[model samples]
Target: MVAPMGYLPQLMYGALITLGVALSAVLFGAAFGLLGAMAKLSASRPLRAVAEAYTIVVRGTPDLIIILIVFFGGTIALTRLFGRTVEVSEFGAGVASLAFVFGAYATEIFRGAIRAVPVGQIEAARALSLPAPILFLRIVLPQAWRVALPAFGNQSIILLKQTSLISVVGLEELMRSASMAAGATREPFKWYLAAACLYLVMTGLSTILLRLAERRANLGYERR
Candidate 1:
């Protein structure tokens, strides 16, 4: 009914790789999202248009398609740019693709979070003669983060699960490892079940950590 204990270590390693990919993707995505949010909120029409276009295109496309495009299209583009063949690693492609997708969604989340911060608070910060950087660092970002945490956490969990898609690109993540094991052992059900359980464990732990982070972020604030 259960997989052989011998295979557990390999699956665990694969899970670690999966987590690494998710974290890297999320970090890169968050950076992009921050920039996108700023652009969306800026007065510059061209910047706003570009950010809007990025979100619309990424959100409209399927994740699998995005992954394939980045893996194949990126290689082709790089080859053309360099006038030589270029090979893109599965890991890099996976991270970049997922980050691009994540950034699109995170852009809206951050934009909404930023907007949720009361205009009065910003006015008050300016009233205090605080510099722009200090005002954002000390006031705006803290509140925005508190507001964004739940949505961001949800996105991170989604990102974690999305790492499985990288298996299609031959990343040897948990799903890929399990599939290979299943093929060798001819135990599809057992290996797939193991992979599912590992994913559940990862997601479950992430939920707990996210809840803790949410609580920490909400410290000294009234909870509704």
Candidate 2:
């Protein structure tokens, strides 16, 4: 079959799906990362232990295995709960799996960034009798975000590229679209090349944006 000239449009549709999934995964992952980081830093031993377990287990497992578990195991759980056959959508499973993996790594990044915030500042906040929330919000978080930006950006890019893995779950994200086009037309080189270029454009744009944000984040410190 001759591949349609509209293949680019199909790829664009898939690209949009990829973008949506990646953004959703990162937002959800950031929540987990923040919570996990705080847990790891908590005074409560139980909280620390739970956080450790999460990072260790998720990081220890390959992402594909985790994707499979969420994709299939979720259905099983839902089936039992509802007393009927239930299915998990590929989009849901893919996003969840990616989020879990991204969170595990981001947890460590956040933990280190939080700790990198000077302790004396926190102590001074306490000396001034500032409430904990105010101290964290006003002093700690801003600095921590600056410290974490480079690492966080790198991890985010990795998560973006990892969106390709969702093709396995049959979500028609970019890579899957390219693969199908290639298979159908038997023009493997051009289709795959197009996919690679699309990915490069996506990653390149993100890198530029991250760099701009990093510069903005540094402006305050650079002034001092």
Candidate 3:
């Protein structure tokens, strides 16, 4: 099926937007994930409970529902709080919701990775009189990062795909562009297939880069 003659450029632009949104969301998600993981690991029961609840609630709900609630509900709440209209852009809503979802998953990934690091190593670092920050940065984080890389990469791919949900909020991302083109051209199969191919390319490239990152992270370790 032939797509409309002038649609490819628009679609490509949309794909770029999708990439930008995915990257931005991942960064935000990583920040949230680190905080959540620390909170969950804290000695304080209330902090642990809050982190647990965040992960359970976000992970249990559908991504689309989260997007809608954050976008619409947040907008309403902000408007009411400020006593004025508050508008949330599709991009903002998309990033916030996806980041939140990604963070929940990442929290578990990071927490498990942190736990996997040898407790003896931490004890040894403390015995050397290393500052807490130095001990964490020099000893704990490097090992934990190696353990977390694979899961984090997987979550990143999932986050990339989730950007499609932004279309519902009127974002002109790849899926939205393909949808609009399909409506206008009456060639749903062609446009949709194109979008799928684009997504495949993005994920494929991402996999290669992530594998390289994993190898780099594994440096100095004995190969199995």
- Give the number of the best model, judged by TM-score: 3
What would the per-residue lDDT of candidate 1 be over residues 1-224, giving only the tens digit for each residue?
44566677878889999999999999999999989998999999999999999999999999999999999999999999999999899999999999999999999999999999999999999999999999988988999999999999999999999999999889989989898888777888998999999999999999999999998988998867
Candidate 2 or 1, higher lDDT: 1
Question: Tens-digit lDDT track for model 2 on 88-129?
Answer: 999999899999999999999999999999999999999999
Where in model 2 is the C-alpha error above 4 Å? 1-3
Better of 2 and 3 by TM-score: 3
Query: Tens digits of per-residue lDDT for model 3 on 95-191?
Result: 9999999999999999999999999999999999999989988998999999999999999998999899999999999999999889889899999
* Candidate with more favorable, higher TM-score: 1 or 3: 3
Clashing pairs in 1: none
Task: Order candidates by TM-score, high to low.
Answer: 3, 2, 1
| Candidate 3 lDDT for residue 143 | 97
- Tell me the lDDT of candidate 3: 0.94
What lDDT score is found at residue 40 in candidate 3? Answer: 96
Which pairs clash (backbone N, Cα, C closer than 3 Å) in model 2?
none
Clash tally for model 1: 0
